[model samples]
Target chain A: MKNNLIKMAIFIKTERRVFFALVFLFLVFLINQGLYTKNKITSQDCMDGKCSALVPEKPQLSRENSFYYIDDLFKNRPSGYYRLTFQEKSNETEKIILKLNTYSEKESFVGELTVNPSGNFQNQEIFFFLPEGFDSLLFAKENSDSDGNIFIKEAGISKLNIESEKELVLLKKTVIGDTKTDLIRESQLSADYIYPWLKESKTILGQIFRSSDEYISAVSFNIDINKNLNPGSRQYVLSLRKVKYDRENASFDGQIIADLAFSAASIEKYRQNDGTFLFPIYGMLEKNAHYLLSLDNSKVSVDKQNYLEFKGSKNNDSYGGGSAIIKKEKNIYIIDGDLYFKIYGAEFHQENGVKILNGAKIEDSGKGMGKYSYAAKGKFIDLLDLEISSPGMGFSEDSKVITAEANDSASFNYTVNTIYPIGKMNFSATQLKAGWKKVSVKYSFNQENWFDMPFSEGIESRIDSIDNMDNSENSDNDSSVDNATDISAETTAQEMIQVFDFDIIPTMKEIKTVYFKITYNPNDESKAHSFALKNLQITADLKMK
Target chain B: MLKKILEILIFAITLAMGFYFQWEIANFVFFILFIFLILHPIPSRFAAGSAIIFLLATAFLTVFKQNDLAETVAIWAYYLMIFTAMLSFGELRKEEEKDII
Candidate 1:
């Protein structure tokens, strides 16, 4: 009994030691868990002066001829989050304000100011937040606007100011270079000049003047003094008149006249062109003018000519017309006349010093009225947007389809464009029996050889395998067992979507083309299987070279 | 002593088989071995203690490694521990009844 007591005591002592050890382990585990929870919040180190700014290279396409512009200052000008990083100087507690000026078709005047802190060259992120609900107002009209133009005169961080209780002073400001502004204005001018005539009809007006035997058409133009001209010439107003097209009447029934005047110094430079200078005359007419407007006589002396003449072609009526001009070789007609013109004034303050007087007149000759028509054989249709569907056809015929009776099969061949990496093939089918059908997919770079597609293990075949088996062999089987199997198989077979993902390391040297075969051999020959494939969309990953 | 040795040998074999094949056959064999162990006469304290040790050791080895067999082994060990505990409780009750008589 004494020996038994000793053994019992030793066991109890060991158990107490183990209990203390377990308590220690549990405490350690709890401490570790607490540490992990505390460390879960991620914090970025911000000591370097260099920081990332959200500078969008391309404008986001918001709609047709409308875009969302993003920059450091105009980050929230578009309805999207623009995340930018700024270096805060260490130990500096001054409040910094980022200022922005924005212009759009809806509103010409929009401004925003955001307060930030300077933390002594520490990298910090500032988010300019604009939600999706405000996207409509944020989207500015692109240069392709049909009406008057709205262009970005200035963008980006216009000013960064430090604020104190006493006053606010500018710390840094973005200066837009003259060359950069010129480039922007040049692109905007191209869009304004070309886009209108490229599309359908819009009302364009000019002036025509008839003084005795001479007829002159004058149209006002805002010529960029900084571009395509001599250095000394600040501004010039040109007066000229030429033939104009009347699209509705299918003839040249009107004359355009422009009376141009320049600052006295610019006038001397304008005459130095040696009577061979050509200026573009832009006009708009009604749709369906039957005649092509061109200069009739090329031999007209440029020195003697004071008015340009445009002749109309003898073609049939069409639906659209563009800006017209009358020219003799490269020389345009210039006439002395009274000027009345519309001036598209420069908006930016930098170009405020430039000045000019411009005028134009238009006169209808009433000789261009006529009726015309043309006939064609067949209609040209665009198939890209056409959605083709057939009723009672289980699926739409947007893709290829193949129908096979019992013991029959069909194959489809597709040529890949090879521009992107082939990712996988997704195939879905209806009316497939679970145990009775077996479908296999294979791919090959070259059509001569084929290999089975890499599929996950235990994935059942889509085609019915029982259709290929002999029907006479299972004559004695109990119907109840068959019925139970059929019910379970039917439930499993109802999942018709199957994805054959490509292998991690594809073995094909080059994927040029692929062929898919669908073999349907029904166990019962009486039933015909109809498979209408909606699409065999090739999923590809774009590879950059 | 012979029964205990046989039970241990069978458990080791099933554990290895479960790791190798990861099939239903190993699970079936383990189930049968558990039933045999439950039916054989053994002390309740010894049975409960040994079952707990075995379960803990198996779980500790496979806790970090995840796959088909690891999952199956973990599940089988849990079920075996539960059944062994129940059997051990029954044996303890029988022992108490005998003492009372």
Candidate 2:
């Protein structure tokens, strides 16, 4: 057949070269699937994590214009208790007298304040105590009569933030802790040196001062109720008792200790038509304290407009430290005058200043978020403000701290809503094991009233003969230094930082929210100890009424 | 030539046992080797030129899809109906010849 047409033209030219090499390999696999579905940028686009930040620098208490100089501060500083909060803005009603010299310019030992300005921006505060360590830190407007030109501005000299919060209806807030203590005004007399006296509460109304220190949350009393109330609400009750005496100081164990029900209508609005308003009771006082004003008014009807009048001290001993009584039915009259009260005292302030807690606000107390964590059995660790309990604690903003292993039942807790009036707390641990009562601290504003804080061996710890688990049970006189430093938490020099301090204010006064609970109990001559506590500081003592 | 190399060595051992076994037993051993190579044959103008380039790229990708491709144009219309049944029973029912399985 003509050789089959030459074998069909060489099999159609070798099947057209295998269909042109499989259509050039399917057009190079359709241009590699269209460049892998249109590119993306993968392998984790390179990775990250590297940081560094710090900004905080704006607390200026400046004044280099002839009037408020702080001799540039540093002249061997640390003498204790300092305060200066400036913000004046006058151009008229002036009468400034803010001196604090020394180093011989001695303008009367660190303390002075007498402003009388009007025309807006007026916030002039002063509280001082240097005890020898100051030559200049000025605000001298020592009154050259009236050459008004005071414009101080947001000044700040914070050394233990002071403002023993005075507010018999002055409600200020903010600026808390560390004037190093003092603020006892027991009777420095001021409401124009005390005068009014009207008396009426048919019975219970004693007033016995005398606690110049040790504790006293709030107590100012200028008396009121002249609206002759047959009104709607009334329950003024106020008790403080615990007056025990014998060593010739008299007082006699009055017992009671805590109760303050207030409401002269939150205290006559404030200076309600003058004479001298004043009103504050807030408890936690301490005679070890005794104060009473209980007036149930027993559903009024004896009519003198439902009675409410108290303010005495126009004469008689004008308060040498105790007087003014009424207690009926068991009789005890004695009232010649002496009830101008204002003991505000409540020390335990802790403010040589160093607070350094490190948690960065850990969170997860059911989504307070802040940091988040989860694990069972009371593993809540949520510290927006704070809470504390431990078992194998764990919180780590890259190791700020919450660690555990050393025990004495060591307790620490934190929380704050900040309405505050008094507070004092401290902590610094490496392996804290200061014995005697081991260590027990308790505090609370609403954690169901815990209160137990008072361990201050006066502050001076640091006698670690090897701890953090007492070096594997006391270095046993050499078994190779007890298994080579046995496992007594090897090093960090016994984790030294020690500080424990906890006096805890009178008890409770103007607290909106504050929670503290510290614990440490393991001490039966130690064995297998462990410790490393970075910080716990919660210094409180801010007042504004 | 040895039954065309034993039918391409049993379709290359059933496509390598359909990639190592159980591909539904390689689709029942390639449906019994397609009933023993359904009369066999193999070249019909290169399978009608690869089924007319997969029926014009799967009918221009199921109807002018314009580059929108992540494969499924009904799997290239089932590989253009197996190359249009190898150009209809492997060469238009042998009207001319060559091309079958």
Candidate 3:
């Protein structure tokens, strides 16, 4: 019975010891887990391609460490206009030139921009067209021997859509005349003059033509300066005038419709009869009205060795619409051939265009820039580009949260330039916690005029009412370290979902680029307060074509 | 002497393999430890000493890498406690048997 008791006592002691060891192991496991959580790394919070979109080089770039460029995974990029934006600062003012070069053995240059960076960091943007074969992009200091250091970061290139087309109109080109040398006929009236008399207002070359188009943007004249051996430049004035051809009083005069001055220096010297000179005539001309296109070198007595003239097909009536005529000191000489000319102006045409954004009809450029369209369907796009100005405010690495440290009056800005015109945007700010005194939302198109966004529906006014009540309650209390924190209904807050609905003005919508700014001002309490915007969303209103 | 040396060689190599690979090496340690339980079980006198040596090695490697130290030590401590308890119970049973004899 005593041996049984002893054995039972030994077994009980062993059981107690095992139980204590388990408890100790459990405590150690808990400690290890806590440490593991503190040291967790979120892969520096970068998603695939997004890290490539905007790169801040880990090392400081300087003259010695000069070259910084991005390939942008060129395989996915299409031939389109791309705008490169970067933040740069220099110890001293310096110029960094960005050049887009080709990838071939021959160093063919494409485009370039010289940026002047000051001591303070500044964001600069330049738009350039990307063509095939010109894939290399490099930024370098103008001087290789500079002592100062320049840092460039957040250098990103985004594809942009050009809404304006300049080279779309060229339908009014007359047949090229080469049979005759129907010149401006610059010759001395007596040959006693040093410079030719026709170089003066004595000789006026005119072509009377009518157009069905309402606007005339520019006029082209085909002439070879290969014949003119003049070393100095000569000024030629092109004038368009309303004509009343009575066949009686022949004069190159009327109320001047439009006139363009051309210098001999701009025309390629000693070149064949080719398309070179373009006279800029920007004005609205009456459709089907007879207007005279005259070229005169009355700016100076024409150079004896260098005078302006145009090529023509002699004895051949090439242009049935207009004939080449020259007036020499009141004599209107008619030539059988017409001078080769072309007129370019705006035209109207009906065509298909992009109608929606990010929809199935668009090709993915990998830049998130969807179909370029005017009438875009409504979409709730998550704003990713965040710029925080306060020292105590920043994006939590995954960019899911805009974290606000204590007393952080943070201005979070997101810039968006969409192809579609924004009519109304729906913004929802989910405030996780609140010690914020006031939260105001404003937006600007030009960054100069900021208008307060009015809420269409949400709990913003309720928050304001709560804030006012809290303010009244705390108005009489003295702020002391020993004084207990007066937790009003405002301080006793759960999550607040404030939705901001604002209709953009028509003028601002025309601007296309909108800078959305939200500022949250936290209360100046000594406690380390933290709050976050769980998410902010933007819903672009759909437009009906 | 050769038998003792062979037993230690098997034990050391299996444990080191267990530490290197989490799954395969763990099975190897299990196989060798079971074999040793039949062939050359750890005496209670050396159980505390062996556990301490294992803990020092765990600490040294943890500090050298500074990665997942807490988890590694926790695992080592749990297994060491189990092995020590088994050894102590075996010693207790042998002592009881000798007392009966």
Candidate 1: what lDDT? 0.29
Which candidate number maximizes lDDT? 3
Q: TM for chain B in all models?
A: 0.51, 0.31, 0.54
TM-score of each: 0.20, 0.23, 0.28
**Which 10 consecutive residues of model 3 chain A have the lowest summed lDDT?**
A171-180
lDDT of 1 by residue, A1-545 (tens): 99999986785564443333334334534543343222110001111211112232332222243444443344335443333333323121223333222444323223222222332123333334333322222323323332321222222111111123122111111111110111111101111121111111111122222221111111222221111111121122232333333422222343322222233122222111111112222122222322222322211111111112111221221112223332333433321211122211122212224211010001111122111111110111111111111111111111122212222333323332322233333333333333333445555556577666543334434454333122111222111111111223334533443334443223554442344443333443322233322222333322211
Model 3, A1-545: lDDT tens digits are: 99999986785564543333334434534543343222211112222322222334443447677666655424457876665656677776566667765555323343444545464455555556666665567776767677657777656565544422231121111111011112221111111111122433447786666655665555655443321332223345566766654333334444565554445554332122233344444334567665677776544333333455565555334554455667666576665556666666543221132112221111112222232212111211211134333334433322234444334344666654444455554455544334433355788878898888764323434554354332211122111111112233355455233455455654543444567777653443424244444445554442211
lDDT of 1 by residue, B1-101 (tens): 74456446555544654444232455556554554554354555655575576667666655443222344455666766666676677678778989999
- Pick by lDDT: 1 or 3, better one: 3
lDDT for A113 in candidate 2 is 52
Between candidates 2 and 3, the TM-score winner: 3
- The model with the greater TM-score, 1 or 3, is 3
Q: Residues A309-407, candidate 2, lDDT per residue (tens digit)?
A: 555564656665566665555554556566656666533322223221221111111111111111111111222122443432332222233333344
Q: Write the candidate numbers in order of decreasing lDDT.
A: 3, 2, 1
Worst 10 residues of 1 chain A by lDDT: A356-365
